[model samples]
Target: MLAKAIFLDIGGIVLEINWRKTVEALGVFDRSQQDQIWSVLGSAKIHLELERGNATPQEFFAFVRSELKLSPEAPLEEAWNQLILGPLPQVDQIFDRYAGRVPLYALSNTNRPHYDYFMKQFPVMKRFDRILTSFELGHRKPDSEIYMAAATEVGLSPSEIVFIDDSPANVDAAGRLGFRSFHSVNSVSATLEILQRHFSN
Candidate 1:
């Protein structure tokens, strides 16, 4: 049985960020342009900069405008906000049930602006026992260092913990490092089941 900790991935696991839905709602750009925009936005450099708190929404907007050759009329911030379209209401309840009963953590490969935006928008989001962001860590998922750091910070053997993430690569990485891991599809229901089974010990 897993004895020590539980870690969650914030993006799709706790909060749903549907970039495609958001861009469509923004209505200024078509699917093709949105795809291009995501290509640039999801680049390692840009994402790392965001995680480090080195970039602001306005700054990202400016960068996108310049790169896409678009005019200043785009609603970048608003469109970005659209990504967090639906907040998972049951998220806190799950944490509440298990936080002190077992160690709980949040690990994400998110940039600064989105991190700030999430905190400001969702007070309940900050309830994790430990919060690890890639930008802040200077290391993102699928990298062993970040996982090592998380386990170290929590003071547990990697074998005693389980890591949950929306990415297969991340799940596999954690698995290789001896963490029990789950790919966070159908997150709340599936995760709660895993936690219940593990923590029942």
Candidate 2:
């Protein structure tokens, strides 16, 4: 089937964010402690709160510290920002290659600061056919409405589009809505190759 649209997730897919690195950066720790930190880090409820501006980074750190019973003196904000590093390399090159060839959109659960940061750092985001942000959209992923909103914004059926996200839940949600989806564990090179193969013929 021809791809009528492409939806990319910002945080993990286009931006190379290593969330576990935040816990590791907190200095050497035993396996048990690491496990505790990892557990808090993977909680979607925490991320949803963070992305919605309902919880500050400091609050998040406190919550994690409380969960792990770690020192309250931990450098939470810095450590959290450490995980949210810069964008992936050659992201623009990939976007440039595919932008106008097909309708392209970005769907992310991000806050105002990060959204502003991205717009300033990468002007190419402005080039997308549409940008659906949870902070702005009031709808987040793993929710069919967000995917439907994206499809509606682009005037395409979900089945005609491909959604790329780091979260399997989000991919599965889109899949249920008739979208062709991929979990973005592989490199963008792999993703581009897949898209090229599908459209080249």
Candidate 3:
């Protein structure tokens, strides 16, 4: 079916990220502590609060410093943002091809700091018709509310919107909600391939 709108995930799909970069930047020298650092950084309980806007970046950074036992003056913000390396290769092609063809929305599960950093650093981000973020929406992906909210914002039914995300769980959630969902597996080429099959005339 032809899509009236498309919702795309930012990190991992439109942009490349490396969590280990953040961990190393934070000075976690022990290999044994890397997994622990990953768990702490990725912990849904801790990170989700930031994504949902329930916790301020300062609060989150303080918690990370305490949890990870980093120096009090650790460059937490810079280190945390190390996860966002840069945009995916050829991502602008997707926007170039589809910007005016159909509505393109960025649906991202992100916090305020990351949002601010990417917005300024990535010019491609300006290409989106709209950006729906977890921090702004108070909801994250794999949750039905955010998807429903996206549909409401665009005034489209789930079936009429094509959703693209790297996470299988998020794709499954969107699919369950009746969206025409595609798992792009963090590849711009894969995303372009999927969009061409559906969005190309």
**Residues 1-201, model 2: lDDT tens digits:** 677888889877777777667777787357687677677666647667776567665666667687656786776655665566666777776677887788788988876656766677667678778878876655678877778877887788998898888888998999999998888753777667667755542
Candidate 1 colliding pairs, count: 4
Which parts of model 3 are misplaced by more than 4 Å?
Answer: 29-31
TM-score of 3: 0.95
Regions of candidate 2 where Cα sits further than 4 Å from its true position: 25-32, 44-46, 52-75, 121-127, 198-201
Q: Candidate 3 residues 1-201, lDDT tens each? A: 457888999988899988888888977767778887787679748689899999999888888888777788888999888889988888998998999989999999999999999999999999999999998888999899999988998899999998999899999999999999989866888898888877774
lDDT of 1 by residue, 23-138 (tens): 67556467788897677767736555666556655676777668666668876666666787555757776777886788778988877667778888887677777788887776
TM-score of each: 0.85, 0.75, 0.95
**Highest lDDT model number:** 3
Error of 3 at 83 (Å): 0.4
What number of clashing residue pairs does each candidate have, in the order they appear? 4, 0, 0
Please list the residue runs of candidate 1 whose C-alpha ends up more than 4 Å from where it truly belongs after superposition. 52-59
lDDT, model 1: 0.77
Identify the superior model by TM-score, candidate 1 or candidate 3: 3
Candidate models: Cα lDDT each: 0.77, 0.74, 0.88
